[model samples]
Target: MLLQETAGSDETLSLMQLDLDDFKPVNDTLGHPAGDKLLQFAARRIQDCLTSDDRAYRLAGDEFTVISRGSGHPAKAHRLAEALVAAFKKPFTIDGIAVFVGTSIGISTAPPDGTNPEQLMKASDLALYAAKQDGRGRAKAFDAAMLELLEQRELLRRSLRMALDQQQFFVEYQPLAEGSRIVGFEALLRWHHPLLGKIPPAAFIPMAEADGMMPDIGAWVLEQACREAMKWPENYIVAVNVSAAEFLTSGLTDRISQTLDLVGLPPERLELEITESVLLERTVNNIDTLNTLNVLGIRISLDDFGTEYSSLSYLKTFPFDTIKIDKYFITDLETDPKSQTIVRCVVNLAHGLDMQVTAEGVETPAQAEWLHSVGCDRLQGYLVSRPLPVEAIGEFIDRAETSVSHALV
Candidate 1:
């Protein structure tokens, strides 16, 4: 009705859609009652930010919508969105607990954007998705580009369902080396779309996680990697990256155990690599799951170390077999004294904790020599070799082993 009225009137109106960021952790950590109070507080704060002509409504589950009428429709809508984001920045005290939350908003002006409710809401929703994708606590206005991206994403989502069935996804193995010797291989997921050529993991992995397709995809990768590793030297291990969604999926441990048994790969020969984000919520369950895998003789690695602020705290909480220093710190290690200092400190710290350190993105001989000199346990990246197809692994391993033996001689 509001959109219809605006369409008939000479004046224009804007619709703004908003979603609260990091709200799920609140519900998971705090009781839902507390979450309710937080939501109420957020609603009041949002209403407070709006002008007299604007109205706010709770759409569903931390999602909100606002209708703004009068002059400068979208401009006023953008201002309201910014104000709302700023409003949430201040902490809300729920039951004497200080809780922090942020919001992402999308805006679409009527007539120019749409004359009907469905079109305007969809435009605003698309804008909202863009805001969230840009890292939350921001606002995005409806644009043709966003619409095109949305269409592309939808097509990709549909294609992803058929991808695994059609065997379009495959795993590539990147060597992880200890000094001159190759210690193991890290399995990297790759996708080759029939029509889209090759799609980067960054483009589709998040979409899979969002659509709840990661568990199946992750399971397939695990089985394939384990089977391939069975063909490698008995002492060599295979490390597979696990997404947070896959890590938290129920029966994940059992699935892995079954896969290892079916593939006739020893649990000790498989390593599961996960980022700090996987332990962000459900810490107890995640710890139990990790412990179960550990009991099965599987190694758990903390990947992309130092990327998150809470990396140190996580180390204290969980006993990770290895920590892979992020590539960001390695890019300028030779030239940057700070990078050298940080890498050295991380290597020392990991060793002190009885955890091995793997330096990723080791692209040059100098970097590898420096990492070796600093007592880094493993090196992975272009310096060792780019990720390889399964058929290439045997030849690469033989060459690497021969090179290591010659160096030792």
Candidate 2:
């Protein structure tokens, strides 16, 4: 089950929660005996948590909780959570089979926190989710601010729906280049949200996809980007991101062709950037779509390479023109050995496919130099320029042109 909730009324109770990760992998990789032992061991640890009236429950596989009568003291619960997480740091041995793992925990309180077991648990679960979102293996306490942020997200989600109806979203283009020469530009969608002000794409894009509203948003971005590209200088390409949710609903080839015909933009000047998650489900179907897009002369870019599941395997199977090494790997490549190794591996792999490689997040001259030396074919980041509106693109493009022309002279 994704989650479980139990409701109770007319009770003032404080609930503390803790969740374990990597708990299932032991059984999945070893045997059920190991899993049982792990669960039993966890139950014992939780039992130790009890003092007099306090009681503990092993709710299900990999989930445990301790509850007692009183108000939720997040400080006390937070310390207990640390002790529990620290317990897992050492390897656990079941019948001489040593296993190691890590976990992330979320904390929540009761009564004023929630009226029932379900609501209390739900609030704690949200806190737990936030812990995992911050990169896992740590615990975080529930706060009013947390709920406020979620409420803001919900409000923004509603705003996103209204913005679409009001035509409040628009496209902004950020140019990508092969060393000072513009090869293409990415079509970024901006929401001039009425209530939330200018909402970042990172804020609402995933929420839309999760709700299956991405098809509408994606269509809007594609149409706006394509139409705007028609106004740019000849040979200036437009790259648009295809949401996985939308990709499942719209045929990639058909979407491009129809959008181009509707906007009077050439297909050759269009590129589609797709994240790895897009290929998770419906592999064969997505492959068919990718191949069709290739045949239609639209460039396909692998967005956020090396950051998701099935990187090398997907590259071997999919039709793509470019591989964009994620900014996370490039931002500190010069200082991070892991980042350098990741970038080097991706560059080699993309080159082996005869595909061009673009290192994103080149925010320093040293980073740009490193990428150039390592055979990265393109670069995109603030080190070059920030994303600009079409009205501002002309001046930026002119300045860039003059700089290059002087270098050539």
Candidate 1: deviation at residue 251, Å? 2.9
- Index of the highest-lDDT prediction: 1
Name the runs in model 1 displaced over 4 angstroms. Answer: 1-7, 26-41, 44-48, 83-100, 308-313, 332-345, 365-370, 401-409
lDDT of 2 by residue, 258-342 (tens): 8888888877888899988788766789899999888888889999887755447788899889999889998788799888887
lDDT of each: 0.89, 0.76
Number of backbone collisions per candidate: 0, 1
Task: Give the per-residue lDDT digits (tens) of candidate 1, residues 104-199.
Answer: 999999788887889999999999999988889899999978889988999999999999999999999999888668888999999999999899
lDDT for model 1, on a 0 to 1 scale?
0.89
User: Which pairs of residues have clashing backbones in candidate 2?
Assistant: 106-128
